[model samples]
Target: MAGIDNIMAAIPGGSTRRFYGTAHWDGARWWAKLGDGPNNLLDAWWQDPVQPLQGGKIAVDITKDEYGQAASFVIGGYTDQPRPSSGTVQEIIPAGVATQIVIMGEDAVAYTTDRFIGEYSPGDPVYLTWDAAKPTVIGKIGASAPPPTPDAPVLVPTNPPGSETLIATASDTYWAPGGWGSYSTSRNGGEDIYTGTWYGNTVTGAWFYGAQRPALQGKTISRIRFRLPARIRGAGNYNDIAIVHFYAHTSGARPGGDVARVTGPHDIPVPPGFAGGDVDLPLSFAPALVAGGGISIAGNPYTGFNSRLKDANSGRLIIDWSS
Candidate 1:
């Protein structure tokens, strides 16, 4: 169902308007406080806290005039009131069968593509009726509708499972092993970074990304593992290692700790070199698997001297650290 806005009371005029704490049908006229204190009129639906009538419901001798129409009611109802967007709504329906859907907008109970009868506009008073198959042009709202396209799969950390810690100078690469290609982190591509302050058991200065910020900042990461993809050689592409490089510092700003340098090739080293041999580079990340500054790919070191690594085949540098 989309939503439930306001419910307008359908009351009749001329009747003595009286606030009723709790009105019960007494054969003839529904009796209650005829005005004199706080319990003078029916409470607002949104204000009321009670279960509504159900199938084959009925309301008799209800005031049908203009003035004494609206009565007490609540805002959301149907399933446990405050409905969940990913929840399901099941009604006996004139046909019968539970149809699940994701509600989108307000007045959701009034909309149902199938077996749609009529809709209850916002602010409509609750009217009791005992006709499960009432043939009326109205139907209760279903669950919220789903989006048109498939949603991107959420990125759930498999390795470290929490914050990752790396020495300011170390070039350690944390890769999620076991061929997990389906998952992707919200922390993809380049993002802004923030540093933390360490105190006691906690060492401050943990860098963070803006878009996909870590669950907590400055969290002492026990350990981290990068989930890497198993690269397959294309037609002409050889089974060579793709070298990854690491930089001690991205910009001129270096965070306190001394830079831990990686003295190795940026790209994954090929056994027989890049001479197109049967021997494979075997994409291994053994070198920079410890607390260090940052890991990068490429043989040629840029401005600030730091750690560098590369893929043996593609040579495309992959960042395998939690900054």
Candidate 2:
């Protein structure tokens, strides 16, 4: 038989009891053997709304069962749900933030132990949320930021009236792939590509490059390449990075029928530190925009090397930037 370690904190007047454990209170039927006795008076059975109360608090109802060992309320929010008040903050759970109650005084003749304190205003209401990852407390209450006033107008982008066309400019400077750019290069090493903005005089066009494999379904242009430098680490390391050429059709659209071939302008160098030393490379072929629904970008397989690494403080990165 399993050992028993439960000690009940009965209400002054009512028979409702609360049990404590190393982790939490299990139901009396299941929490019979807690091992450790009630260590503090704050440990008691209570049922409070899971939502965070702004200025008010609610009462907790505690009572004893027929056989009366000790029992506590359990719900999704009690262990799973997040506190409603976690607005813009990542909404992390606070340590030692248990849902148990502290018994201040019990009303002996009332037949109901005053489970909790704090008054609830008529205005405040409870909210609901979910946590499939784990069990949580229910009815976590939180406050939403008040609407901003006109003087404190919330900033939002506004489209100009009747403006249909957009224009963008191409910079000369080389930019790292997937990195932001506005820089100009000296000899056009196939490094910088950007979305052209539409001006009254000029209609800026988008840049596209790389192998246009129409037969390969789901094959997409990785990005609008202003430039794609070769793998210039030394001799034989360069593979002639692709460049942007001219568009087949005039209007910028998807699944573009026109394709551009390799246009000259090759260089070989390093972009600082690879296996050591500078790495410089040049663009091989010109790039062109793709249109229609047939193109798609491919994803890379993730390595768990980052998973095994821990933060300096020894914390694990469960949810990554991409995750």
lDDT of each: 0.26, 0.24
- For candidate 2, lDDT tens digit of each residue in 1-323? 11232234334322433333222333432121234344422233222224322212222223343444333342112222233321111111221342332211112111111121232222323232223222122232464557778688666545212211111112121123212222222122332222121121111122222333243223222212222222222211111111222222222221222222223223222221112221222212212222211111111110000000111111111110110
- For residue 77, model 1's alpha carbon misses the true position, in angstroms, by 32
Over 4 Å off, model 1: 1-164, 170-287, 291-294, 299-323
Least accurate 10 contiguous residues by lDDT in model 1 = 200-209
Q: Please, what is the TM-score per model?
A: 0.18, 0.16
Candidate 1 lDDT by residue in tens digits, 1-323: 11111112423342222222333333554333222343343333221233333221222122223333333322222232332222123333333342322222233453332323334433333222212222122334352456756787867775453333222222221122311111122023211111111121111111211121233343333333322222222201122223333232232123334223444332322210122222112223223332222323332211111111221221112233342
Tell how far residue 10 is off in model 1, in angstroms: 59
Off by over 4 Å in 2: 1-128, 136-144, 158-290, 293-323
Q: List the lowest-lDDT window of 10 residues for candidate 2.
A: 300-309
